[model samples]
Target: MEFDEERVALYETILDELSPPDGEAVSSAHFEKELELENAYQAIEDLIRLGELEIVNTNCGHVRVRLQKPVPSSTPSTRLEDFSENTVWLAYIVSGSSPRQRRAQRLFQNFEVGEEHLANISHTDSLAQVPGLEDVWCEEVKGLSTEYAILRKEYVFEQADDPWP
Candidate 1:
Protein backbone atom coordinates (compact mmCIF):
# COMPACT_ATOMS: atom_id res chain seq x y z
CA MET A 1 0.00 0.00 0.00
CA GLU A 2 1.15 3.50 -0.82
CA PHE A 3 1.63 5.92 2.04
CA ASP A 4 0.90 9.60 1.85
CA GLU A 5 3.56 12.10 2.91
CA GLU A 6 1.79 12.81 6.20
CA ARG A 7 1.53 9.14 7.03
CA VAL A 8 5.18 8.55 6.29
CA ALA A 9 6.15 11.54 8.38
CA LEU A 10 4.02 10.30 11.22
CA TYR A 11 5.62 6.91 11.07
CA GLU A 12 9.07 8.45 11.25
CA THR A 13 8.07 10.65 14.13
CA ILE A 14 6.62 7.76 16.05
CA LEU A 15 9.68 5.68 15.49
CA ASP A 16 11.90 8.48 16.66
CA GLU A 17 10.00 8.79 19.93
CA LEU A 18 9.75 5.06 20.41
CA SER A 19 12.25 4.84 23.25
CA PRO A 20 12.06 2.34 26.10
CA PRO A 21 9.87 4.20 28.58
CA ASP A 22 7.24 5.17 26.05
CA GLY A 23 4.27 3.15 27.23
CA GLU A 24 2.99 0.50 24.89
CA ALA A 25 -0.67 1.36 24.84
CA VAL A 26 -0.74 5.09 25.31
CA SER A 27 -3.98 6.87 25.88
CA SER A 28 -5.80 8.17 22.85
CA ALA A 29 -5.41 11.66 24.24
CA HIS A 30 -1.62 11.37 24.32
CA PHE A 31 -1.54 10.11 20.79
CA GLU A 32 -3.78 12.91 19.62
CA LYS A 33 -1.19 15.34 20.87
CA GLU A 34 1.28 13.97 18.36
CA LEU A 35 -1.02 12.91 15.52
CA GLU A 36 -4.61 12.98 14.48
CA LEU A 37 -6.58 9.96 15.68
CA GLU A 38 -6.83 8.25 12.30
CA ASN A 39 -3.21 8.81 11.34
CA ALA A 40 -1.82 7.69 14.71
CA TYR A 41 -3.90 4.55 14.67
CA GLN A 42 -2.86 3.71 11.13
CA ALA A 43 0.80 4.33 11.90
CA ILE A 44 0.61 2.09 14.96
CA GLU A 45 -0.95 -0.67 12.91
CA ASP A 46 1.70 -0.38 10.24
CA LEU A 47 4.56 -0.42 12.73
CA ILE A 48 3.14 -3.42 14.55
CA ARG A 49 2.80 -5.37 11.33
CA LEU A 50 6.38 -4.51 10.38
CA GLY A 51 7.63 -5.92 13.73
CA GLU A 52 9.17 -2.59 14.61
CA LEU A 53 6.64 -2.00 17.33
CA GLU A 54 4.70 -4.29 19.65
CA ILE A 55 1.91 -4.02 22.15
CA VAL A 56 2.61 -5.50 25.57
CA ASN A 57 -0.68 -5.00 27.33
CA THR A 58 -3.56 -2.63 27.95
CA ASN A 59 -4.14 -1.24 31.41
CA CYS A 60 -7.13 0.60 32.78
CA GLY A 61 -6.71 3.48 30.36
CA HIS A 62 -3.36 3.01 28.66
CA VAL A 63 -1.50 0.51 26.54
CA ARG A 64 2.06 -0.72 26.94
CA VAL A 65 4.23 -0.80 23.85
CA ARG A 66 7.75 -1.73 22.88
CA LEU A 67 9.96 -0.44 20.11
CA GLN A 68 12.48 -2.79 18.57
CA LYS A 69 15.70 -1.15 17.52
CA PRO A 70 17.54 -2.25 14.42
CA VAL A 71 20.75 -4.05 15.29
CA PRO A 72 23.66 -4.08 12.85
CA SER A 73 26.39 -6.67 12.78
CA SER A 74 28.91 -4.07 11.65
CA THR A 75 29.37 -0.39 12.22
CA PRO A 76 29.37 1.93 9.19
CA SER A 77 31.14 5.20 8.63
CA THR A 78 29.71 7.87 6.34
CA ARG A 79 31.79 9.98 3.98
CA LEU A 80 30.66 12.97 2.00
CA GLU A 81 32.50 12.97 -1.31
CA ASP A 82 30.82 16.18 -2.44
CA PHE A 83 28.05 18.29 -1.02
CA SER A 84 25.73 20.65 -2.80
CA GLU A 85 22.28 22.09 -2.33
CA ASN A 86 21.21 19.47 -4.84
CA THR A 87 22.99 16.37 -3.64
CA VAL A 88 23.03 14.33 -0.45
CA TRP A 89 24.63 11.01 0.50
CA LEU A 90 23.87 8.48 3.23
CA ALA A 91 24.85 5.01 4.45
CA TYR A 92 23.05 2.51 6.67
CA ILE A 93 23.72 -0.90 8.21
CA VAL A 94 21.22 -3.74 8.13
CA SER A 95 21.07 -7.21 9.70
CA GLY A 96 18.68 -10.14 10.14
CA SER A 97 18.42 -13.91 10.62
CA SER A 98 17.79 -16.54 7.96
CA PRO A 99 14.42 -17.28 9.46
CA ARG A 100 13.50 -13.76 8.43
CA GLN A 101 13.50 -14.97 4.84
CA ARG A 102 10.08 -13.57 4.16
CA ARG A 103 11.15 -10.17 5.43
CA ALA A 104 14.28 -10.34 3.29
CA GLN A 105 12.25 -11.30 0.24
CA ARG A 106 9.86 -8.44 0.80
CA LEU A 107 12.78 -6.05 1.19
CA PHE A 108 14.42 -7.20 -2.03
CA GLN A 109 11.19 -7.00 -3.98
CA ASN A 110 10.39 -3.53 -2.71
CA PHE A 111 13.93 -2.24 -3.38
CA GLU A 112 13.87 -3.35 -7.02
CA VAL A 113 16.44 -6.08 -6.56
CA GLY A 114 17.02 -8.18 -9.67
CA GLU A 115 19.84 -10.09 -11.32
CA GLU A 116 21.73 -6.80 -11.38
CA HIS A 117 21.29 -6.67 -7.64
CA LEU A 118 23.12 -9.96 -7.29
CA ALA A 119 25.88 -8.58 -9.52
CA ASN A 120 26.35 -5.66 -7.15
CA ILE A 121 26.46 -8.04 -4.23
CA SER A 122 29.05 -10.20 -5.97
CA HIS A 123 31.28 -7.25 -6.87
CA THR A 124 31.60 -5.84 -3.40
CA ASP A 125 34.00 -7.81 -1.23
CA SER A 126 32.15 -6.49 1.76
CA LEU A 127 28.36 -6.64 1.56
CA ALA A 128 28.35 -2.85 1.59
CA GLN A 129 27.20 -2.33 -1.98
CA VAL A 130 23.95 -4.23 -1.82
CA PRO A 131 22.29 -1.60 -4.04
CA GLY A 132 19.50 0.25 -2.35
CA LEU A 133 16.99 0.94 -5.11
CA GLU A 134 15.02 3.10 -2.74
CA ASP A 135 16.08 6.57 -1.70
CA VAL A 136 17.53 4.86 1.37
CA TRP A 137 20.81 2.93 1.26
CA CYS A 138 21.76 -0.07 3.43
CA GLU A 139 24.62 -2.60 3.54
CA GLU A 140 25.34 -6.04 4.90
CA VAL A 141 27.98 -6.41 7.60
CA LYS A 142 28.49 -10.16 8.16
CA GLY A 143 26.92 -13.53 7.64
CA LEU A 144 25.59 -15.34 10.68
CA SER A 145 25.88 -19.00 9.85
CA THR A 146 24.40 -20.05 6.50
CA GLU A 147 21.01 -18.82 7.60
CA TYR A 148 21.54 -15.05 7.66
CA ALA A 149 23.71 -12.37 6.07
CA ILE A 150 24.21 -8.88 7.44
CA LEU A 151 24.40 -6.13 4.85
CA ARG A 152 24.65 -2.38 4.44
CA LYS A 153 24.08 0.08 1.55
CA GLU A 154 24.90 3.69 0.80
CA TYR A 155 22.55 6.29 -0.63
CA VAL A 156 23.19 9.21 -2.96
CA PHE A 157 20.35 11.57 -3.71
CA GLU A 158 20.09 14.31 -6.31
CA GLN A 159 18.38 17.03 -4.42
CA ALA A 160 16.27 19.84 -5.77
CA ASP A 161 16.13 23.54 -4.99
CA ASP A 162 14.72 24.21 -1.55
CA PRO A 163 11.74 26.49 -1.94
CA TRP A 164 12.32 27.79 1.57
CA PRO A 165 16.05 28.24 1.15
Candidate 2:
Protein backbone atom coordinates (compact mmCIF):
# COMPACT_ATOMS: atom_id res chain seq x y z
CA MET A 1 0.00 0.00 0.00
CA GLU A 2 1.10 3.51 -0.81
CA PHE A 3 1.54 5.97 2.03
CA ASP A 4 1.09 9.72 1.81
CA GLU A 5 4.53 11.19 1.24
CA GLU A 6 3.70 14.19 3.39
CA ARG A 7 2.56 12.01 6.27
CA VAL A 8 5.58 9.77 5.86
CA ALA A 9 7.84 12.80 5.83
CA LEU A 10 6.23 14.12 8.99
CA TYR A 11 6.62 10.72 10.60
CA GLU A 12 10.26 10.67 9.63
CA THR A 13 10.81 14.07 11.15
CA ILE A 14 9.25 12.89 14.41
CA LEU A 15 11.42 9.81 14.29
CA ASP A 16 14.48 11.98 13.84
CA GLU A 17 13.55 13.91 16.94
CA LEU A 18 13.01 10.76 18.99
CA SER A 19 15.87 8.69 17.62
CA PRO A 20 18.57 7.97 20.18
CA PRO A 21 22.29 8.05 19.53
CA ASP A 22 23.77 4.59 18.81
CA GLY A 23 20.39 2.90 19.15
CA GLU A 24 19.99 3.83 22.78
CA ALA A 25 16.51 3.81 24.24
CA VAL A 26 14.41 7.00 24.20
CA SER A 27 11.28 7.69 26.25
CA SER A 28 8.04 7.40 24.29
CA ALA A 29 6.50 10.11 26.49
CA HIS A 30 9.04 12.55 25.12
CA PHE A 31 8.01 11.68 21.60
CA GLU A 32 4.34 12.28 22.31
CA LYS A 33 5.06 15.61 23.93
CA GLU A 34 7.17 16.77 21.02
CA LEU A 35 4.76 15.46 18.39
CA GLU A 36 1.65 17.23 19.81
CA LEU A 37 -0.80 15.38 17.61
CA GLU A 38 -4.05 13.64 18.46
CA ASN A 39 -2.99 10.61 16.46
CA ALA A 40 0.68 10.64 17.47
CA TYR A 41 0.13 7.21 18.96
CA GLN A 42 -0.01 5.84 15.43
CA ALA A 43 3.29 7.39 14.43
CA ILE A 44 5.24 4.97 16.61
CA GLU A 45 3.26 2.13 15.15
CA ASP A 46 4.08 3.25 11.62
CA LEU A 47 7.76 3.70 12.44
CA ILE A 48 7.90 0.18 13.80
CA ARG A 49 6.33 -1.14 10.65
CA LEU A 50 8.84 0.77 8.52
CA GLY A 51 11.74 -0.74 10.49
CA GLU A 52 12.96 2.71 11.44
CA LEU A 53 12.39 1.95 15.13
CA GLU A 54 11.84 -1.01 17.44
CA ILE A 55 10.11 -1.01 20.79
CA VAL A 56 12.64 -1.99 23.44
CA ASN A 57 10.23 -1.98 26.37
CA THR A 58 6.96 -0.66 27.76
CA ASN A 59 6.35 0.38 31.33
CA CYS A 60 2.75 1.34 32.11
CA GLY A 61 1.78 3.66 29.23
CA HIS A 62 5.35 4.70 28.48
CA VAL A 63 7.25 3.18 25.57
CA ARG A 64 10.98 3.06 24.79
CA VAL A 65 12.58 2.57 21.40
CA ARG A 66 15.77 3.16 19.46
CA LEU A 67 16.69 4.12 15.94
CA GLN A 68 17.22 1.22 13.58
CA LYS A 69 19.43 3.49 11.44
CA PRO A 70 20.99 6.87 11.88
CA VAL A 71 19.56 9.84 10.11
CA PRO A 72 21.93 11.69 7.79
CA SER A 73 22.67 15.34 8.46
CA SER A 74 20.91 17.85 6.24
CA THR A 75 23.33 20.72 6.80
CA PRO A 76 25.70 21.37 3.96
CA SER A 77 29.43 20.80 4.40
CA THR A 78 30.80 23.94 2.69
CA ARG A 79 29.64 26.16 5.50
CA LEU A 80 28.03 29.48 4.66
CA GLU A 81 30.85 31.24 6.48
CA ASP A 82 33.32 29.75 4.00
CA PHE A 83 31.83 32.24 1.56
CA SER A 84 31.66 35.99 2.08
CA GLU A 85 29.48 37.40 4.87
CA ASN A 86 27.75 39.16 2.00
CA THR A 87 26.49 35.77 0.84
CA VAL A 88 22.68 35.61 1.05
CA TRP A 89 19.93 33.13 0.20
CA LEU A 90 16.87 33.74 -1.99
CA ALA A 91 13.79 31.65 -2.71
CA TYR A 92 11.23 32.24 -5.42
CA ILE A 93 7.77 31.99 -3.93
CA VAL A 94 4.95 31.14 -6.33
CA SER A 95 3.13 34.43 -5.87
CA GLY A 96 4.26 37.84 -7.05
CA SER A 97 5.47 38.85 -3.61
CA SER A 98 5.88 37.16 -0.27
CA PRO A 99 5.18 39.00 2.99
CA ARG A 100 7.69 36.82 4.79
CA GLN A 101 10.37 37.55 2.22
CA ARG A 102 9.48 41.20 2.23
CA ARG A 103 9.82 41.35 5.99
CA ALA A 104 13.08 39.43 5.87
CA GLN A 105 14.34 41.67 3.08
CA ARG A 106 13.70 44.68 5.27
CA LEU A 107 16.09 43.32 7.88
CA PHE A 108 18.82 43.09 5.24
CA GLN A 109 17.50 45.99 3.21
CA ASN A 110 20.52 48.10 3.96
CA PHE A 111 22.85 45.32 2.89
CA GLU A 112 20.90 44.24 -0.19
CA VAL A 113 21.15 46.07 -3.49
CA GLY A 114 18.36 44.55 -5.56
CA GLU A 115 17.42 41.22 -7.13
CA GLU A 116 18.99 42.43 -10.39
CA HIS A 117 22.32 42.63 -8.63
CA LEU A 118 22.20 38.87 -8.00
CA ALA A 119 24.05 38.52 -11.30
CA ASN A 120 27.12 40.05 -9.63
CA ILE A 121 27.12 37.77 -6.57
CA SER A 122 28.78 34.38 -6.50
CA HIS A 123 26.20 31.72 -5.67
CA THR A 124 25.35 28.07 -6.16
CA ASP A 125 22.12 26.52 -7.42
CA SER A 126 21.66 24.47 -4.27
CA LEU A 127 19.03 25.26 -1.63
CA ALA A 128 18.92 24.73 2.12
CA GLN A 129 16.65 25.63 5.05
CA VAL A 130 18.30 27.77 7.68
CA PRO A 131 17.35 27.38 11.33
CA GLY A 132 16.61 30.16 13.88
CA LEU A 133 15.99 32.90 11.29
CA GLU A 134 12.26 33.16 11.87
CA ASP A 135 12.48 36.91 12.37
CA VAL A 136 13.51 37.33 8.75
CA TRP A 137 11.42 34.70 6.96
CA CYS A 138 8.11 33.24 8.02
CA GLU A 139 8.42 29.82 9.59
CA GLU A 140 5.40 28.78 7.60
CA VAL A 141 4.09 30.21 4.32
CA LYS A 142 0.42 29.31 4.51
CA GLY A 143 -1.33 30.10 1.25
CA LEU A 144 0.86 30.00 -1.83
CA SER A 145 3.56 27.49 -1.18
CA THR A 146 3.09 24.25 0.71
CA GLU A 147 6.75 24.01 1.71
CA TYR A 148 8.48 26.56 3.90
CA ALA A 149 12.20 27.19 3.55
CA ILE A 150 14.72 29.68 4.84
CA LEU A 151 17.80 30.90 3.02
CA ARG A 152 20.48 33.35 4.12
CA LYS A 153 20.59 36.23 1.72
CA GLU A 154 21.94 39.49 0.45
CA TYR A 155 19.27 39.50 -2.23
CA VAL A 156 16.35 37.19 -2.95
CA PHE A 157 14.76 35.91 -6.13
CA GLU A 158 11.56 33.93 -5.65
CA GLN A 159 10.00 31.23 -7.81
CA ALA A 160 7.11 28.89 -7.16
CA ASP A 161 6.82 25.17 -6.78
CA ASP A 162 4.03 22.73 -6.02
CA PRO A 163 3.75 20.30 -3.03
CA TRP A 164 7.51 20.17 -2.54
CA PRO A 165 10.51 22.18 -3.66
lDDT of 2 by residue, 1-165 (tens): 124565555566666675333446776777667666545556655444333456788897867877543333334431221223333534333112321232222123432333322222312233332222121221233443442322334322234211111
lDDT of 1 by residue, 2-87 (tens): 25576667667766565433234454345656555456755665545434555666576544555532322122322222333222
**Candidate closest to the true structure, highest lDDT:** 2
Off by over 4 Å in 1: 20-29, 33-38, 59-62, 70-165
What is candidate 2's local distance difference test score? 0.41
Going through the candidates in order, what is the number of backbone clashes in each?
16, 9
User: For model 2, what is the alpha-carbon lDDT of residue 54?
Assistant: 66
TM-score of 1: 0.36
